[model samples]
Target: MNGCCYGRPTRLPWGVSFPPSSFAGLEFGNAKIHPSQLYFSLAGLVVFAFVWAVRKRTGPAGTLFWISTMLYALVRIPLDFTRAYEPETAFLSAFGIEIVESQLSSLAIALFSLLMIMRLRRESLAPSAA
Candidate 1:
């Protein structure tokens, strides 16, 4: 499952072959692919650590949520390129760059998070009516 869930199958560069039972779902004929799930897990840990580290320094409540959302999108947009995904019928393309469904969703989430962060920040800064 995890192996097949993400990333395209990669062929061995030096013509290396493994027994089909060697890695179970990790092998395809004579090639091993990028462990995209592991990559994603590692990236998630990194994001968590970074956000946790900065939590105390970040101003206002909910800032970390927005920051983390943006961070995930930033990493995922590039990371998804390494994975194999079905061609989207409703994707956006421009200047030779295509945005797939997952990427588009990430973008929307990040943008919405940013807007909410800004709104919250503005609210936090405004003088309170005693």
Candidate 2:
């Protein structure tokens, strides 16, 4: 079910394309993906390496997955600001502060991953069963 989850359509001089029927959802009638997706993809790889290195220093533990997620959110939210967005994109709000849905979702993911990492660190530091 890979619907149009890229969040926004791209308007670059050289953008991407999808078969009209291939995409089940397209409010903008554009065939290309957001140009920022390129940035996100490349940054994602860098973040993966960074998270891997950090996890190695931290411990060969279960928190790498959580760490990766947090790092990805850190990478995405900022880039999203520069991405071209259509009018129909869903948004999330807090106390009259309105933010794009994906950005807010990224924040939530980062927070949760941070919590998981902290909890896991605490557990790892605790004394093992005798």
Candidate 3:
């Protein structure tokens, strides 16, 4: 059987409510946060497009994968900046770290890019002297 029968209903809870609000007048405290999940999903699709475009380019087997992942991370980081985050409290910690979303994303991209470059280099060198 499909999983839907076993799952709960998908509608929002009946008691929850929201006042009519516009994007411009909404403050961080009063406004609903931007949907970061949907943003990331769109970013993923963009990355897929990029990978598909680059797949046939002459370079390495895994280059497109790495590039796509890096770009996705880069996009997500900046997008996260526009989102609302909960206030830090004694019970809640953002891992005790204070990194801008873009910075973190860039770092991840850099590391993955480096790994891809190294892997490509090794692959290219493998059959050269044989």
Candidate 4:
């Protein structure tokens, strides 16, 4: 998680080109971009800190995980727009989709957040005597 949140964004500029060669036709320039990985890493750290603060205040089981996941999803969804992506890549074209790594990560985080939320709700509703 930290690698994805910190490394990808920073390392990409050294060699990785956006809109990759697969989409050579697309207009792409070698512009020094922001270090998004660092941003994501900081975001993760903030979420971690928030979760740590709320761990005792929140309920049991997956509460922290769910909340963190939701926060990550929310942040990633918008970050996707800022990151470069190749719309013509096999991964994107496979399902007639146009999504980048950030978008995919956001989707996964959202799904996990939903699942955790449901689990937390279920646990809360269960009989205490059981």
The TM-score of predicted model 3 comes to 0.55
What's the lDDT for residue 88 in model 2? 61
lDDT of 2 by residue, 5-63 (tens): 44355566666654556552345454566545567778998997897677667653778
TM-score of each: 0.75, 0.65, 0.55, 0.59
lDDT of candidates 1 onward, in order:
0.72, 0.70, 0.54, 0.61
Runs off by more than 4 Å, candidate 3: 1-32, 89-106, 118-127
Q: How many clashes would you count in candidate 3?
A: 0
Q: Which pairs clash (backbone N, Cα, C closer than 3 Å) in model 4?
A: none
**Global lDDT for candidate 1?**
0.72
Worst 10 residues of 2 by lDDT: 22-31
Q: For candidate 1, write residues 47-103 as lDDT tens digits.
A: 999999999987789899988988888788777765655557338778866678888
lDDT at residue 107 of model 1 (Cα atoms): 81
Candidate with the larger TM-score of 2 and 3: 2
